[model samples]
Target: MNGDWLLRGRDGRLTVYLKSDDAVLCRAELAPGGPWEPFRRIGGDLGLQQGPAAVGQGDDGYAHLVSWRQAGTGESRLVHSTHFRPLLAPLDWSPVGHPNGRGDRTGTPAVAVDDRRRAYVFVRNAGGGVSLLVQKERGGWYPWRDLKGSSIQDQLAAASRESGLVEVYAATPERILHWRQEEPGRTPTRDETADVAARPGTLRALRTSAERTTLFFTDQGGELCAWRPGGKPVPLLQAAGPGPVAAVRCEIDGHDCTVLAQRSASGRVAFAAYPTEQEQAGAWWTESGPPLPPAAEIALAVDAHGTLVAATLDPTDATLRVTRRKAEAGLALEGWREV
Candidate 1:
């Protein structure tokens, strides 16, 4: 599955990422509700595979991407690249060596920028535990540290609070393992387990408030569930599908709401909105735009005008297809258009 492709910068322009046959491609919107510039290759590496795990910062006007490319020795080398934000050209990628060093087996990588403007990358190691590498604010990396959590699976979710504190989560066989910084600009000491069961590829974490986050995932029964740290797991909707779920916190019709999008079982992109952190309030899914490819991932964000935007790969081609709502049309969407 692809990593995050749609990102919004501090200045409000949208950056989109796509995977080509050999390289990772990116493009940006000319304006909030305008046409996008042509796609360009981010790096010269032909060994790059899959979409990148993308992170955009409002603090710094830059987009950060982490992905793995094959080395001459058949090792999975992890690399990171940054873009000059508000829609500028890409820069040279800085090499972030693999977590395992030898690059044996690494899971999907998760990335987030801390409040101090530093970036952290997390991935599942070969031992079924998590390892991390932290980049300093001015561009230097600390030694790779092994974050112990046995029997961990993929789909590790991570987010940094406004305070510059970071949290990393991994799904184990029977529960969720969480590691968080004790304070801003500090490395997390250890792992704390949350007795929550989530499907392997369906975990997503987004900030519900200034420095707090809520995790969303499907249960074994395929029902939507939400859990905030130090709180009980709240079962949301029944059978919200087992596909990748996209979420963002934004204001809708004068109310601060949390919005979620997922590809329904019938292949259409559908979404629902509810009060942020209030999953018990009940929410309904509304199908929007058109049906996407069965395996396509939806990228959702709020634009500069507070307008909600959703993007996905075209059902038949390499182009990006995007859909947004009308001026005052709630979730009712305008038609799908290409980048």
Candidate 2:
């Protein structure tokens, strides 16, 4: 799982989905780091291109998940499911539905819920164009609507503000595109940001507030860069290795910021913080954390109380380990405990 895979549900409960050997497994913690429920197999006999993407604890108290199901021949399609009550026993999941018709080669789907509690799913289709589907406030999903574009290099990232404004982003070989829908039924607007390197990596967007969104991706040189709506790309950190970079909106001390975590070539995970606004240039990035066990990729999420959780697969044993950091701990890597 990549961007925002972990979701916070009722009572500070957290839900995450991962691709195990043969199925998509889901588990929930009553709180940030304790007494996790037994793994529940949600889908089986399946091929998953990426882990599940989810929107948690909507106004109706349901968590929605979307993922691509690949057939044995390698063709992919989109399927969705919902958890009616995420914090209860005998966890009830709605029947899986094929929302986007059959036989479409799609990337991992991205989901965002607006202030009105309407849910939207975004994905890059086989033709390289993006498609969107909406879940009505009453119930049920609309047919997939094509939002045309070409040569999208990776999966889409989406975030919504309290004002009901939804922003979605994707990268092409030459530039990154941003799409905005001011309100649910209004026409969406599109624009391209500065030109970027023509390589494939994660394209992530965070809505730090109603007024701003920050985009993060790996440039051609493998260095991590950040771009605001109309600003130039700012290189934040040098590339330590080749893999997906995971980020989440968080707050440290008295500052609201984006926290980034990535694995180096040697498999050690490092983190840095980029303040929403900085008074000094060099003060923007905090020191990198010490190396951890070798990991192929890292997934990040912030709990309800603002504790940062970092999850990765242990290289030696392939088991998922989750670690949490409180805001008071600053950037130290010393308090991580496996969940």
Candidate 3:
């Protein structure tokens, strides 16, 4: 099945990654009053791609993408695209050598870009270990460095230029690894077994402020938990209810209002807007209203100014859907053509 999406900043503009049937990563630009440009296919040498990361915008208006390709010798190659401009299809896209890490089952690689357009890749090794790799601007890739000894699940976390201290949390079958790069090029401070529990899927990070971050993951019992440093992990939602949560997302509205998207097992989407009175340390979530339109895939990201944007595929119609909502305005769901 096609996967849901998450957003990361490239330059000033946001880059959206959508898995397409053509085996190439599709990208588009979103600007007010501007048209939703056609999707550009970022190719991979292998028959299909492992997926691409929207690292950020480079020095010029070029977009930076990092992905993996399977080598003819049966090794996984971590590749980065040259600076690419929207609308102008790249004459040819290639991978950056040097900083290479062992690749897993073509899963999406975790990526973050600093202000200088340098890209960082975190991937699970062949033996299921977690490692960090870096590529400096205009410099060749650096050799892969093992960040932790424990094996990591596919889900990994990272932060970029605006994200003051980038944090990476990877879960092993029995433990979790929290790696923090206080600053680029500096050795990453390691926090081993931050939590002792198997987490479902990947680790997702949301930066609430310059110094605040919230980490989301599901425990072995299938209950969702939110973890912040200097505090304990709180149960966002328990699994003993109507059904297990299929998905979860954190969104910031105007006025710094934070909301969460929870997809229940019954195919109902829950919009939980946190109360403004509580602290960010806990899993506290207040219902916004109802579920979103049912679909097979959903992708969401909030803008720098706290605008919530989401895209989903309509199961019945087989079409792409994009939605945006301001602080006070209700959701605006439209097709790709409408965006």
Candidate 4:
């Protein structure tokens, strides 16, 4: 599942972007916790490949979206479009030439928009190493640069911290490899000190604080774990399903807390809340709604009112099913509704 399928805008409006057979479609909330607008095609008319898609929103409220279109042989040509401001509408998409030449076979890409409004797109190169393409100051893109990683999984993550520096998290069978800029507007270097192990396709990185990013992943024991750059892996939940977990740090009961939306072992959407980085203090998890199929993923976001919003694309009908936690009602969830 893509991390950005469901995300709230800077103005408190939530937008969901999904990949269909031929194009990418999106729906924007008319207002925060309000009615959603009708789905509109946003990927131009490019022939998109059958793959996962990603979306990154800048501090300016602009969104940078990326998807793959079939290229020569088995490779894919990367195509991108920007939704200027918070409108969540794009006129067309332009081709961002692949790093390994004409889409020479790459993994799923992740996008992170820095404080300067530049978009950093990360992907696994043809040789299983990570490479990234950066958006220049104006509008053009710089050539792809390899980040020196190996055996990296296709499921990876990239996030921008409050300091404006961007950090990328990827997993190999052996350990977790990371790339973080020493400061804003600099090239990210591999930080081998991040010693952690994660199962393939289950690693996620998000900035839960102004200067720190926490990683969520399933360990060899199948338990969900959280880790930071200089800390040990902290077990957070048990029997977590495969794929990435959608998490956000927000307030609950006037306390700073981290909320998690995960697919549980029973194939249901499970949510948990605990004090930020305080696993030893205990956390609570609850499952709700129907047991979803393995292919579907739950998207989580916190609205302007600090309410948690979770949604999943129904694999059967391709419709979006959403639920949100009642404001200040602990972890209580509202009934699921079809959108």
The per-model lDDT (C-alpha) reads 0.75, 0.64, 0.52, 0.80
- Residue lDDT tens for model 4, 75-132: 7788888876445568587889886876454788889899999999998888899999
Q: Top model by TM-score, which number?
A: 4
Compare candidates 3 and 4 on TM-score and give the better one.
4
Alpha-carbon RMSD, candidate 1: 2.1
Query: What TM-score, to 2 decimals, does candidate 1 have?
Result: 0.93
Order by TM-score, highest first = 4, 1, 2, 3
Q: Going through the candidates in order, what is the number of backbone clashes in each?
A: 1, 0, 7, 0
Off by over 4 Å in 2: 43-62, 70-76, 89-101, 277-280, 283-295, 314-318, 326-329
Tell me the tens digit of each residue's lDDT in model 2 across 71-144: 54755556666665546532323333343465645566777666667767777776787878877778777666
RMSD of 3: 5.1
Candidate 3 accuracy as TM-score = 0.74
Q: By TM-score, is 2 or 4 better?
A: 4
Runs off by more than 4 Å, candidate 3: 1-15, 27-34, 43-47, 50-63, 82-92, 97-108, 161-164, 239-254, 275-295, 303-306, 314-318, 326-339
User: Between prediction 1 and prediction 3, which has the larger lDDT?
Assistant: 1
